[model samples]
Target: MTGPLHEQSVLVVGRAGGIAHAVAVAARDAGARVIAAGRHRQRLADLYAGEPDIAAEAVDLTDEGSITALASRLGSLDHVVSTASARARGRLGDLAGDAVRLSFDTKVIGPLLLAKHLSPRMRQDGSFTLFSGVAASKITVGTLAVAITNGAAEVLARSLALELAPLRVNAVSPGVIDTGAWDALGDQAKAQYFADIGARNPARRIGTPHDVANTVLFAMTSTFLTGATLPVDGGEPLT
Candidate 1:
């Protein structure tokens, strides 16, 4: 899986588990050499310890120096998928300014910086896929911060598509996916939560990490696609 990507080197930046983990495996299966990058070194290594085809690297989005160094180290890549995000939740009036800045740093500014530095080293046919969320469109009292930041990701993707030109840029917005991202809720609560959400969805089921990861694959491999946000939310927005 890790031998020269067989296709192109795919750099997936985010935590070593959950959706990022799924994406890495999907990329490797799709014949791309997969480099799983994130801020946590141990987690990154642990995520791919036995996977010879997948590599791991450490990179932080908040630090420009870190990202710049990573960009230089990568030299060239065919696809870059940033699934890194700061989990956000708070009412509009209750959130702190610093929290807002950090949210944007992770979701919006980070990807912009990636395009700024990494785009230069990307192949003409390469693409950048960002992870947005259904929250970008479905705003609630508690998801105000997440909504704004995710909305910004969509905007950033569109603008980057135009600015980056030959290198395509797009975003994938997922709904309630059973990716273990909600494992903190414990098994019973998590199951109940997903079941509740699933019942309301038109698909009558919660999404899997593969659903979103598959979308990432399309964004990078489809030569004609660009500047679009593909929703893997299964009618969450429509509902």
Candidate 2:
């Protein structure tokens, strides 16, 4: 924490793992005053202790009052990225109604609330970036909540771009990133699955957290880009 983002302030929500973790690192390295936000206050403090100019802020996506309180604490923001998401992965019938609604709360409503409260504190060239997944394009079974929520996130970004004009709004749709999202599959099984999927990808490799994070950095700095959903999926869509 060295490039165009030097001295800029960026707040990345959902700093617990994977792509969000990498994005925070990338932004901090780019010299931005990174604010790592999540529901767990102690977790963020412990996780970001090794970094300089990175602060920890607590927020709950489902709670508007929590977001409002967090907003008052941040002085100014150059970029805001919400990688916050919740999903209940199972057949539609197996999932409860509350689970599906919660997914939308994290994926769609959370970002909207952020824009509502944080927009006023943003710089003239500031931006908001959201995280989405390839499930929006590649529909699969037992992932109904994931697919629907991610798709809605894309639309939310685009819609907000128009409403939050002059301030850019965009999303990164990552595909099969090696971000421990599949750790439940077990180490050996996860590795083999990645390799098999990589072989079919146009990029000839499954995505890494860095790949997605780099794209997020782009979305943050590219002033002319807005209402766009960039697919950093290693061309997995082609397969």
Candidate 3:
């Protein structure tokens, strides 16, 4: 089970499923102790109950106090990957102020607070891997809120990389991954959407959770790579 992260402690922040869960599994397999934290502690705990190497905890990214508490509880960590996001989809006219605010609060400000509180406890070589998305680069019509939030997240990563110094900071921007995130479209529609994206994108297929997870693992181990937004979008932005 030993790998690049052997014996290190990794914290993954997000829900029980999707890309965050994939990252946690990858980190654990890489021989790191994984703490899966999110707003719902019990659910995450239940999800990873069988894994001795993965522990589940609670932290609300929107609340700085919660982030502080989690940092205090953990004391020290080797790496952190944040995949939490609240998407505010739809055109400008259909967007709600609250939804847009929640998107920024969850994706951007939350990660900033995590860095503020967690960086002190991290090793000088440890890194932070935040999640961005293709929306930031592609700039489509129905995803204005998502694009702006993701763009801000990239900037935040770069700024943190400089401000945090020896502690590295980076981002993973995924494209149309076939996760539950698209389940809202229902089975039939989701399939069609994936087909359309797969055909249009250079990779000619939708991304998998592992596609993004592998990148996060690389970010954690690749000390030289910092302040960069690595895309796991199957080259979607190019097309």
| Highest-lDDT candidate | 3
Model 1 ranges with Cα > 4 A deviation: 1-5
| Native-to-model Cα distance after best TM-score fit, residue 187 in candidate 3, in Å | 1.4
C-alpha TM-score for every candidate = 0.95, 0.96, 0.98
Which digits, one per residue and each the tens of the lDDT, describe model 3 over residues 43-157?
A: 9999998887999999999999999999899968999899999999999999999999999999999999999999989999999999999999999899999999999999999
In model 2, how many backbone clashes occur?
Answer: 2
| Residues 163-198 of candidate 2: C-alpha lDDT, one tens digit per residue | 989999999998988888799999999989999999
Task: Name the candidate that leads on TM-score.
Answer: 3
Give the alpha carbon lDDT tens digit for every residue of 57-101 in model 1.
889998889999998788689999999988667887788888888
Q: Which stretches of candidate 2 lie over 4 Å from their true place?
A: none
lDDT of 1: 0.89
Error of 3 at 117 (Å): 0.7
Candidate 3 has an lDDT of 0.94
**How far does residue 11 in candidate 2 sit from its true spot (Å)?**
0.2
| Superior candidate under lDDT, 1 versus 2 | 2
Q: List the residue pairs that clash in candidate 1.
A: 2-53, 5-33
Query: Which window of ten consecutive residues has the lowest lDDT sum in model 1?
Result: 1-10
